[model samples]
Target chain A: MMHSRAPVNAVIMPRMTEAVVDVRELRKTFRVSEREEGLGATLRSFVSRHRKDVNAVAGITFRIEAGEVVGFLGPNGAGKTTTLKMLSGLLHPTAGEARVLEYVPWRRENAYLKSMTLLMGNRTQLVWDIPAADSFRVLQEIYRIPEEQFRATVKELTELLELGELVHKPVRNLSLGERMKVEFAAGLIHSPRVAFLDEPTIGLDISMQSRIRRFVAEYNRRNGATILLTSHYMDDVVALCKRVIVIHRGRLLYDGPLADLAERMAPYKIITATLHDGAASSADLDAYGTVVSREEGRVTIRVDRHVAPERTARLVNDLGDRLADISVEDPPIEEVIDRVFTSEQTTVSA
Target chain B: MIRIYRALLVAQIQAASQYRVQSILWMLFAVIRPVIFLAAWVAVARSQGGQIGAYDVRDFAAYYICLSLVINLVTSWNAYEFEFEVRMGRFSPKLLRPLHPIHYSVVENVVWKLTTIIPLGIILVFLALTFDARFRTTPAHILLFVPSVVLAAALSFLSSWVLATLAFWTTRVHAITTLWDRAGFIFAGQIAPLALLPGPLQAISLALPFGYVLGVPAEILRGGVSVSTALVLMGGQVFWVVVFYVALQRVWSVGVRQYSAVGA
Candidate 1:
């Protein structure tokens, strides 16, 4: 909306051709009924069932273009996975209008299911006792992939994931990371146009995580597949998503560039500096910025974006001899989110 | 669907191969049931002048042996499998797949029995020798019984599918399955032939699909049924298979709806 005549809108705006995914005012609530243990409680519940409703996702709306990879960001219980389940036809919204790739997902028709894939980490779909290749073969049948196409895709994915050595090992024998890689290969062998990855790298080590990240990125690039990724690790968001949608407490909080999010919630950048002398006065540092922490001339400051350059320049020019080392950095993404979600509870504008 | 089943079968076999000790243990251990029944029935026949319900002890031996072999082939463990799969959230992955999950589970259950059948057959053979029971070979009986057992397998699979899908509602389909298992055991003629049960229980056996799997086929194999009567019972198995299949479809839709409501 800020860019009045956005050029990217022409080719990429999810248009009349049919939004690949459209969700508006989506809502889901669970009726948590109290169950009495004994005969008295049972009889009481029969007459007066105490019901509590937990609103998992409340009045959320969004759209995805034909081939956009959008990151879904939210703290646990913020309804990110709930939304994903609705999109993938695993769950239905209690009240809402929604569509995925031109089909009502809760219907979960063979046609709609054929064109989409869901991959979740930690919870496995593979047969635990079998080789990963065996699991992959089963997927081919489930998706009704043509023999040749299934072969070709399995070959390509196996090579891309470097799964040759790992694919034949029994699933129970494979390391967690190895199993996840093969899970991806099995999920994607059908070459679905839409992929929902929920915490797909949840428990993987750094190297394995990056390997999966690269594989996903490469797959998207090659096929122009639309992706909806959810992860707790902020680095996953930073590495994979250009556009992110943030939700908190079952409500949409922010939908925009990730960089803009960090900028908006945390308006100030962090700076750590060490001085030549341990006796630098804390009061003197206030002129430069809000002194977050100062210890033996190892001072930390929060400098507002507008004043960061001038403040740093002054600190350098005025305290040349006193300053030993200075480094300006962005606060961790988690801190930015904590402020946005917990501290300021700002209503999201899409 | 068949293709999906074949793949799942291959995978289950691979999984079974991983723990050779456990796999063998399961085979040797579960084999006790048929032998126990065989012994009990043999004792009954001996006390009753080597016959009960027109079966000499030798005939009872042959009947129970064949029952054990075919029952082992046809029975499914989905009721137990679903309890775990549903309770632990393992059922989600199957819902995510494009194929009907029943196919995956059905194939795996049948394949697992392939290993157990030998032990079952061995126990049955042992009974045949010890009981001095009437035993006979009839090409006609084999011809009719084979397809009856297969149809029985389908019936068993679909009934359990309906039962397992109830997880979406109560989350404790396990308790319900215990009843189903007991009913299957009694009415399906696991403990004894339908003819040997009291009159009222026999009526209930006829009303349910259980006897069609174990009793009807085993009945014919023991020279109990005329070819015409055998034809009618086989028709009954086929009929119930359709009924159970349709029931499975209805339960699946309702279960899926309930699962959606629960956000499962």
Candidate 2:
């Protein structure tokens, strides 16, 4: 909401034209029944149960255009999954308006369902005892995908995900990564125009995660499908999403480009300098800036971003021959996100 | 729509074939109960010196054999499956599909019957030969039996589906299902032919839907009921089908609202 990236919003925001996904003041409250842990309490619950309302989503608004891949990042239990459920027609909203492809998702009309897909990392929709190939055939019938279209999509997904013999084996027989690949393939068999992917790369090895990410990116590129992805791994969001919407405690804290978020939340840059062995003052590196680390003639400093250039110049001049190699870089996006969550003023008026 | 249903049914059949051992055990289990009842009734008839309430040993054999077949064809385990899947959170995926989740259970029920049909037929022939039971089948009765069986399947499924939706409210519906099964067993003539029951119980059986599901079809197959009686029974089956179908629709709307309010 800040002026930091306000100009970028103009290019991304869909106006009167129908956005692929539009959500406004969406809310979902769950009435969780509570019970005491004792025989007497259990008996009492049978007569009169205690219940409390927990608001999972508290009036959040966002819109996504066609072919846009937006990163939806939040801490654990921050309502990311719950919000996705509402958008995908799995859970109805307690209040607020949500439309996907101009259709109210909770109605779950066949046309709405055929046009979108939701892939939750923790849930497996494939039948465990049967081969995934058979499950794909079932999906084909469910989505009513023509035989040739289904076959072509499967072939392309198989090649992209490197799924050779994995589809033919029982899902239980496959490893976690293998099963995840099949789940991805099943979600894409219909070539849905909009996809809600929650933690799609969860539990995969690093290489497999990158492969899956690449596949998602390629799928979006080919189909111009709109996607909203949620992940705990910053690498996924950082690599795949230029724009990110961060929410905390069921509230939208920030929505802007990743670079703008890093700049706004994290005002500091990391400066690493290779110091001369003889002239290096190891014990008091903080005198120059906040000492991040000092090891093997290398001294890292955390300095204000705006003053990084001046600070580096002064350090080089003051150290003279003592500084061997010096470099300044922005803090990692993960650290910036950590700072954003810890900051007291999360809702920056933009 | 027909192609989708066919694919669903075929998938379930193939999926069931994977559990070959369980399927065989299920077939054996289905036969064991009726065979035990047949033995007990035959012993009782022998002790009674000829017949009890107009049912001789051969009559009891024919009755039990037909009861087994009717029960197998009509009964559905949708309630049990729904209970398990709801608890496991597996029902959510079914909801995401464009089709209704009940289709999965219906197809599963049909596939199970198809898989066990050969064994059920073998058991029927074995019972007829071993007990020297006169398995007479009239052309009219056979023709009537087909629709009766199909209607019975629909009635059972709709009734059980109504009970299955109870999972949306509470996890435990075993007691409900058990009471239903026992009621059907006692009143629907699965334990004994309707004619063998007391006069009052026979009237109750005729009035209730359970009798239409199992006892009526079994009677038609046994060649005892008249054509007019068969028509009345068929009418009763259709009546119950309409009643349960409406009940199922009403229950489903309320249950899905509950499920959506809570997470499925």
Candidate 3:
């Protein structure tokens, strides 16, 4: 196994080309009141309140280049949403600095706001009682989109999203997936250069999720916009993001190309072999590696990444006539991510 | 900015029109308070030999009817609504837009007032016929009343917005808004005419901004105020409008900094 740790406070300098989004040691602390679930505690809280500070975002630093799609990965309470809020100007950080499009986000200047958008899956900006097209018209006015441009954008979005009749019906009458599609179209009406998407595919069916993933990928491809996306679904990350930033409990655990995540964190490979008819029993496979599963003439083993090649070669040689088929590959991304979070000593940078 | 307001206004009107039944019901509900006050005052005037403090039955009817219309025009619920928006994290979407969130609230208020105007007019006609109300108004009073009402609405909306911005620090603003409403009821002559109050209370009513929000406009419309006095009251309305506008800006800037954007 191989591992390396960057200093927690290390600062990574940006490249020659200016980054579209840059954050340095951003932090947010919330003072939340506490009380027991009883009348006595409630009465006492009125006289003397008990409060505690929660560090929702603890000194995270990252830079995103223009036109790059980056996956922001974390478990629940991992501060992904907090960081997005700070960058989108929905929240003011307790400390540190962040610049998006060369403007301080929290200043919320019109020029800054005009250049970016934040889309939350659980929330909606469309007026509930009106058709989504009407809401889109309002967005056009708010963003100051010209009439010709607004019409062309709407046409392109409708064709891309297949929003045909959905835009004509009131938003309240639409299904969740239909509403989400409309939401995406509305959020992008201005063609924002920077987009922060928080769980944009959440709670959608598998087919809808795949559709949304494709839409996001195509949107990025066509517009060349920089996007920071947060999702619990591994499929979303695999489909769209080339690079990922992982956090745990408000601490940055990893930042690198997605291809290197498993190599750096799991440090292991999985090998599967199909034995010939009655050629060798499961017990005979012990010398090769840790047998993870053996059933129906197939045996799967976990081997350290460093020696996986040698082990596979030996197994093939020993079972020359007995081995019908064999394959070696990295472990599943979900499994690798799980290992990264569970392994207390695991942290890597690239 | 005006274009954005126009778009919001159109959208709000479309949304509000979807709930016509609810709007009419709310308008009817709003009529109850002024009607009850008018009935009580008229009864008192009758018992006091057909007059009390320069208000006969007809005069009482005119005052209450005008008060009802003025209240309807200037009423703002942003204080209560803003608290809910902040608590439930609905304000986040508004903050993301290039326009200020206050623009949405302002347009919604204006659209709501506009949508209820026909219904309010019918109700006004019914009330006048039932109470035998006689209004005394000159062209001068009528001309002055328009700006008075506009200024009153601005003052009321801005003050409520300032109170609403307090929700960033205290998520529950019901108590604060209730206190404000109580103060308006006392000092704005919503409960009784300012002339009928004690001298000390009359001075307090004149000194506070609430009288400008409700009482002055109503008085001007009923021809109870002379031209010079109407000018002075309009000046007072303008002063409060500026004060509340500045206060709203200051409070809103500080409050947005404190926003936690909870619930998502």
Candidate 4:
């Protein structure tokens, strides 16, 4: 199973633009020590321990053009974080190559580091006991930002994030959302050309998540920075990213525009009809398409994407006045991505 | 680089100032071991008819008093702190920064010393007056002691940083740091003056970097060594500083590679 590598569905970039972040077959394999749960085994293992090679990031490849906000989508342990770490220069790849802004990431040169930023939602660089503004000053010095530029950037971030007095409070005293806003501001203080954001909205309330999503979109618009964002929240991806790269089990499963993902993976659409006087039953809907659900007076069915309009028209004509309300829509992005992973499994097993 | 260091120093000082009471308590706690050693040595000297190997009660008082201050000035807890940072994944953010993470540690150490210095100085003065300790120091010895203490601080910090880099390879650095502190306790003349140790042990202490970290500086401050001897010891301190610095750089490069390969 460890050696069962999946083929990559590479995304082709336009020839007119140079890729800001380029990766080719980037991989990272880790040797992990293993031990069984037993005192005798533990005692014996002290003398001769066992280890296994686990490929956290199998040979996967993709590219992002400048000013593009691309979603890096994958489930847990799908090597999404590993690939981001490699691209951000926090982890070295065991093989293959990656370059950000034409600099080899693993070299970790000052110029390269200065031009990029990686923000992990669960981690923070702010000093816990002090006000976040103090930490920003330290970062200003570390990045050697001039006084005028530093003040201007801070003012801009404060206005954009709505962090008026929050920056003055000790970081430990601030709420998680407020702290994250400051973390984002601190990361952007240098105005990096490339940003890798890992789960930026992992545990925020819905309203806060919307605010952050908007901030990211606006930041990208203003700076023209290339952003690679990963989030389990499908809303973030659907709202902010026009294109997405989906990886599964250390392999690139699909990479294309977010709109095309459902067409390619699901190739189906959903149609819902609210009938009057409970006129249509599940049995009646099955004739039109696959009955997805029948709750109360409404019936939902799945049909081929190309036949969705025909299915809807037939339902309206057959039911006539009984069809009080009707609508046809594409499947949710989450369901499409789930099918992508499950179908890939079927293909691999076959 | 200077701007970065200054900024880091200001930030660390501000953070440390918030815990002034805790800092004072920790500094007082550090005085305990030296005070115990001082009492024991003074007792031993009194029992041995007011003198034992050139150290009378007053001399023991002066020696241990200076030893306490010197140890406090040069001590670094970075090995333990680094281990915790690595285990908790706190080091990852530091790695992402353009500056080396060691600069943070270095600045934190300096701030810790700065915050504790005035209080520790008062404690040292009180001990000196309480014990009626007399110093036999010349102007020349005082001048040389300045450089000796500075060199000692550099050597001690670099050595601790070198040990701290081991955290990249192993999460459990407690045992290693424990062993290091134990060796430093004996060989750095924390428990006793290096001159009073057995011939073989004294030679071993001199051969190790620990002696230069605390022992030699304390001895110099107490006016126990000649000017030429002090210069020679300073040279040794310089050599160990260079050695530890080179070792730190080499170990850090290798350790970061290991970290990047295996991850935090």
Q: Name model 2 segments beyond 4 Å from true.
A: A1-16, A276-280, A295-297, A344-350, B171-175, B198-207, B260-264
Q: Write the per-residue lDDT of candidate 3 for residues A1-350, one digit (tens) a residue.
A: 12334533223444546899988888888899999999999999999999998888878888999999999998888899999999999889999999999999999999989899899988888899999999999999999999999999899889888899999999999999999999999999999999999999999999999999999999999999999999999999999999898877677778778898888888889999998864257688878889999888899999999999999999989888988899999999899888777763344333
Q: Global lDDT of each model?
A: 0.79, 0.84, 0.89, 0.88
Q: Return the TM-scores of chain A for each candidate in numbered order.
A: 0.86, 0.89, 0.92, 0.95
Q: Summarize candidate 4's per-residue lDDT along B1-264 as a digit string, tens digits.
A: 998999999889889978899999989899999999999999989998989898899999999999999888889889888888887778888888889998898899889988998989998999999999988889999999999999999998899888888877776688998999999889989888999989988898899998999999999999988889999999999999999999998998888877842333
The model with the greatest TM-score is 4
**TM-score on alpha carbons, each prediction:** 0.89, 0.91, 0.95, 0.97
lDDT of 4 by residue, A54-127 (tens): 88888887888899999999989889888988898888789999989999987889898889999988887899
Question: Taking the tens digit of each residue's C-alpha lDDT, what string does model 3 give over B1-264?
Answer: 888888898899999989999988877777789899999999988998989987899988988899989988999889888888888878889998888898898998898788888889898889899989988889999999999999999999999999999989998899999999999989997888777878998899888898999999999999988999999989999999999999988998899999888875
Each candidate structure's count of clashing pairs: 7, 1, 0, 0
Query: What is the per-residue lDDT of model 2 for residues B1-264, given as tens digits with 9 covering 90 to 100?
Result: 787888887677778888977986887787788788888989999999969986889888887888789888988988888887877777877887899998888789888988988877987898889997755558898899999999999999999989989887776577888798889878888777888888889899878888888889988987768878998899999999999999989988777756642332
**Cα lDDT, model 3, residue A38:** 96
Deviating ranges (above 4 Å) for candidate 4:
A3-17, A279-282, B260-264
Instruction: Judging by TM-score, tell me the better candidate of 1 and 3.
Output: 3
Index of the highest-lDDT prediction:
3
Judging by TM-score, tell me the better candidate of 2 and 4: 4
How many times do residue backbones clash in model 3?
0
lDDT of 1 by residue, B20-65 (tens): 6775577655556766887898787788787787777777677777
| Worst lDDT 10-window in candidate 4 chain A | A1-10
TM-score of chain B of 2: 0.94
